[model samples]
Target chain A: MCRAISLSPNSVLYAIGSRSFEKASRFMLENGFSPETKVYESYEEVLDDPYVDAVYVPLPTTLHVRWAVLAAGKRKHVLLEKPAALNLSELDTILEVCESNGVQFMDATMWMHHPRTAEMRALLSDGQRFGQLKAIHSCFTYKADDDFLCNNIRVKPDLDGLGALGDIGWYCIQAILWAADYDLPQTVTSWHEPELNQAGVILSCGSSLYWKDGRIATFYCSFLTNLTMDLSVLGTKGNLHIHDFAVPFRENVASYYSASQFRVPIMSEHSVANDRPQEALMVGEFASLVVEIEGNGSKPEKKWPEISRKTQKVLDAVRASIEKGFQAVQIVS
Target chain B: MCRAISLSPNSVLYAIGSRSFEKASRFMLENGFSPETKVYESYEEVLDDPYVDAVYVPLPTTLHVRWAVLAAGKRKHVLLEKPAALNLSELDTILEVCESNGVQFMDATMWMHHPRTAEMRALLSDGQRFGQLKAIHSCFTYKADDDFLCNNIRVKPDLDGLGALGDIGWYCIQAILWAADYDLPQTVTSWHEPELNQAGVILSCGSSLYWKDGRIATFYCSFLTNLTMDLSVLGTKGNLHIHDFAVPFRENVASYYSASQFRVPIMSEHSVANDRPQEALMVGEFASLVVEIEGNGSKPEKKWPEISRKTQKVLDAVRASIEKGFQAVQIVS
Candidate 1:
């Protein structure tokens, strides 16, 4: 993430902070941070820096609200990594602070800013090409090694407590929401037999969502399977497919497949090349938003934060459905 | 189907039958069947022919039992089209008579005969490449024109009574079962909001299945969407993807994609060339099984019958789930 920010033309990896200055220093040195980059022993020190216009919070999901709120309070633009927070309530808290303080807030979902994503969006919104969305299936899974499963922050109940559902599942849910043009689902239902660790953190799970208009989406996220990322969006007239969705196989050129009303359906692969990595683009996008607010005295962009909140709400509903023994949980919004 | 049977070197298109002699004659002429091929005014006439070793029943769901039973009673090998019967009871009656008569029974699920399917099965069974089966998603959907939606046999309550769930959904359910090596799921649950016509026949729907081992599968079938047929099988160690699972894009060569453990996950597309179309291969396989029974005095192959039964069972379960308002219906076998 630090490297991603540094790669952005308008962004800089200005500071490193951790409870341990040595660990932060090691991270800075190992990641080839500039020698002039500031190192702070406490997160408070980074937020206190007068020259720091923004702070990127890459803390575990459990700490998102605290750190993001602090950054917002300090008048720092907030770029928070996903899953944005443990739940919607926490995310709302962070967003509220950002709103009150006039700080731009965007979660770090790199794929959202990829050039390939824009190409996919273009095809999906074209009625003649894609028509009305019917169903979507998004999956993101990775085999987590024994060491990581046993000791990773993701599996720890106190850290990224949502585990695979929050870590990778967020991407899947986000993809579904993104494909649906951010329309909130009317109902959410989790699949039975969600794999959970001893601490009750989800390791793997799946859920389905339904819209009032009869459109539906299903997603699966797992830390117990071989690395696979797929986003398939089917519409009345066409289809959109992305295999390497969460992360592109080739960073520079991302490829997607689409077909429109073929007498014999045949998907044609379309590739979009980016001048910089997707993460860099995400950083650049976020940085530009922060620039607009800080330099032009513009209000913060609500789009990114609104997207984050919806993703968080859907995630919470999925968790609720899982907890309620896979019952259908109605989404009020 | 006549063309497929004629293409197989060992299987000749022996007979055509319809209620109308003119219709049967038209079919025989259109397909360029051997001039000596018999055209019967009724299905029973074709079944009663002493030289006809096998009969392919392409009748609608309501008529399957009567015609299949007649063929089996006449000691003709029964090659039944998919959604073999209205439900398990009907299929069981057909199977029982075939068993009693010592005649071969097989469903006309053409993809099962594709060489590419065998390659996919090999990879899925390989513990090193694919590991234990985890999740599957099979979707087969096609847009129905105005005329078809209003007048097609598939949409009629008394014809293809199962509607989309029986027509195209049959292929999706069969694909899931075939990928799972015919292990029946313990529970089946339909997604809410299945689209239905005025006759209460499903036009579009989806269902999810669960095994006791925590493996899961979901499938979507529709007549209200663009043409899309996909079978995605995800295992612990690898993934198998087939875009055109129900029908191959090319008749001579079929393509599929698979990937094993990769730190950087990547899918490699593979094409398997076939001497004939999958339908021809299916007919050839069924014919060979019949020949073994008739010539070698061997018992009918139990594999194909069992596969067809299981597919029908799952399809029935999905209907029950949908009828019961998307409740999870437990499978006895």
Candidate 2:
């Protein structure tokens, strides 16, 4: 995030804070933050700085509600990392505060801001190329080393409680929603036998989502499998396949295949050669939204918050499904 | 099947049969069959021909038990097209007769005979490269035209019976089984709300399979979506991804990607330079087994029959899960 802000034209590494002053200073120095960037001893001090326009929260899932609300209370726009609050109610509280604060709020899903994202979206939405979508499957998995598995915050119940579901499943769910144009599924059913750590944090799981029109989406997320980001969107006329949906091949290189006639793999010809990296673009996008409200006195865009809320709602439903022994949980608005 | 037999070294298009003599003659004419090929009006005449050592049964699921049983009874080895039968009982009946007659039995799942299949199997089985199999997702889908959807034999409950599940889902289920090294799942649960034709035949459906050790697999098969054959086998160390698992790009071309340590895609460098197409290889394989039985008095191979039975067992479990309101159906046997 610090590097992204440093590279973002609309944003800057204005202030950073940690529990330890030395750690904050070290982080700033190591990340090449300018000498002018302020390093605060405590998080509240960062929010207390009246000159700060927006704050990016990279705290664990458990701390999102508290710090996000506090940051919003300080009238600072919030750019929060994903698994934004553990559940929908907590997210709603933070979003409500941000709404009342008249500050922009967006989750830091960097891939959303990538040029390839919009290019893929355009192809998916094209009637001639994709037609009506019938089904979607997105999976994001990576092998977590023993050290990380045993000690990572993701496996701690009170920290990144949702574990792999929150860490990588967030991308799978978001990709599905993005493909479906954010129409929430009518019901969510977690597939049976999700593996959980000793603390009961999910290590791996899968689910099936059903819409009213028979359009379905399935996703699997795991911390135990090799890194795999496979997103396949099936339409009536063609299908879009992305092998590296979560992380691009290189920092800036990404490509996909569109197989319309089943056997024939049509590699997408045009590569997205964007100069700015995705993280920088994401920070730029969030900061520009903040600028709209800050300089133009415009309202915070409702779209981002709505998307976050829908994703949270579905996550909550999945949690409920798992809790209820893998039954289908209806998603009531 | 006729074409495959013609290309096989041990097999020949010795006899052709249809309901009408002219239809059989025209088929032989169109396919460039030798004038020595006997055109029979009745299927029984071809089976009755003592010179014919094997029979390829491409009949619909409804006729599988009848034709395959009759063929086996006449001491002709049976190469049945898949969804081997409508139900396990039917498949079992066919298998029993084939065993009694000492005739080799094999399902014509062409991809299994492809050299790429064995190459991928070798890769998946490698402990260092793939580790223990963790999860798998396979989907085989294709769009059925309007006329075909309404008039096709597959849509009729009395004909293909299982519809899309029997036709395409067979490939998906078999692929999942293959990736798991033919270990049947402890339980199977069908995903919710399958689209059904007016005759109550499945047009699209999905299911989850679970092993006792927490290995899981899911598959979706559809007749409503554009042609999509995606098979992803994820293990701890690396993952194998095949975009066209069911049908290759062309007759004899196929490839896969293995992305180990997450983002690094390691495509297998050496492509299998097999000269024969998958279907021809399938017939050649089946015919060679029959030759061993005929020339050397070898007993019918049990491996092919067992694989067909396991696939049928899972299919039956999936069907039961759906019938029981998507409940988890235990595979007791």
Candidate 3:
């Protein structure tokens, strides 16, 4: 939904191959896109479309690598949603293909693009305001609907990846990583509610990330919960809080305090909606990237592998913690 | 301090043999109690006093059993603050002494007397409001003050009693046990932060309790944190939330909701001070108990060992979990 709407004005929408071409055509038409948009009945048809300069692969978790590789084979830039792939190996494969094909590939993590989040990161990182970052805490949770149990991609581990952690925890993992300037943690210990479908699939999860400088990050994610998105960072001098990151009009406020004193009115950032922006501002950024790719051969932005690998490492540690019932799991990197 | 303030109206202060007599006298005078108020510095001096019919033992955690037994042997009713003792055997000793001497002993858990908490318990247990409770989640954390750390009795394994779980976590444990109608959990699993010191005892602690009927209770306690007290319970029909049990006035609201639909407000029994009146209410309850003991024989309203033993068992399991690091420890009823 986001991809079809985010393309440049002159960009062509090359519909991807799915189980039903007519349904895909109707989807495009309903969303006000031209019905004449090239509709591919198979994966090869979409890849072979010469007019298609970029592909937005919102496929199942397991299919992420396969589709990204196929898109890269056709030299098409790609935007993949969270949990880039099932594991680091698949992520590595996607990265290798995209890099070798000279195509721009980026994970659609819109959380970092949110203006409120940017403001928070700035306050926490600025040594004058918060000093050295000490700890990061986050919680992202929401109850799933009825169909979520039976046919949802999230429940199907092979498709949606890991349960709660992979789906929502990736945001928390990214939050900590981004706050610490992508500094990977050395150790991770986690605990998960055992009633989850499998040992690895958690209903509610908690983890602690230990960094080299004695800094730590703790996070909680749950599928069976009321909707909540909260991020808090404590530093030597002060602290920063971002209330809600996922929603546009949600109450997003960042506050910094020193020596137990409120310093100023909490800075407020209002999210700008480009059009049908449901998930993240990343859609707008991805749209800009498409223009950049069309104008120049490459983007000056950071490469995909650098950030994707860091996220993959956190996800891997989180998985190991869940499997080990939250014993300290070493981050190989 | 609580005992002296509670007995202020009686114009009599009983100081058991533990601290210096001059020190007790100075403490009483500093607190605005009359210096002439009877201060028997020794345990025998206080017990032999015809005016001293009750005792409040704020001794070390391990000495609770010994002092309570001695007070009971002297036919003095007792109000002993938590952890009850180091173990169940000590509690048994106190119980036998009280029974033989015909003196009453009650663990001083003031949370039970908080009017709002009483209302919360009734609403949840009403069956029609919350149905059969399935789960309870609680957390209590606070950054330790300098004085608390300098005179850190809680750090001493035998003196301060149990770490976070025994001191602050005991409140959460009691809340769960009371909510579950004293039905002990069949299995318990726990995790504790590795570091413990005088300045910061336990960084973070979590315990999971599993009952025979599938009811689960989970709680977290930390001394190295900003103050937070929150509790939530989920049942078959609806859910209940007690924002802050210890200090009810600090945004404490209890309500039951089903499927996003608001039910009737779980009526909170409003005491004179519904806000942060826990301290005063605790003093009043103890004073009333003192009056009951003086008016009648030593026996008051409830026995101590029954509740103390159950709490100790839970604390023991939490300690085992801390030692085992994520291993489930079964509670032997």
In the range A240-310, model 3's lDDT, one tens digit per residue, is 55445544333233222222113432222333334333333465566567677668666525645678789
Report i-RMS for every model.
0.8, 1.8, 6.6
- The CA lDDT at B106 in model 2 is 99
lDDT of 3 by residue, B179-225 (tens): 78788998877743444664444545667687865467777676655
Largest DockQ belongs to which candidate?
Answer: 1
Off by over 4 Å in 2: A261-270, B262-270
**Rank list by DockQ:** 1, 2, 3
* TM values, all candidates: 0.99, 0.98, 0.77
lDDT of 1 by residue, A33-144 (tens): 8999999999999999989999888899888989999999999999999999999988999999999999999999999999889889999999999989999999999888
Local error of candidate 1 at B209, Å? 0.6
* Docking class for candidate 2: medium
Locate the minimum summed-lDDT window of 10 residues in model 1 chain B.
Answer: B257-266
TM-score of chain A of each: 0.99, 0.97, 0.87
TM-score chain B for all models.
0.98, 0.97, 0.83
| Sliding window of 10 residues with minimal summed lDDT for model 3 chain B | B252-261
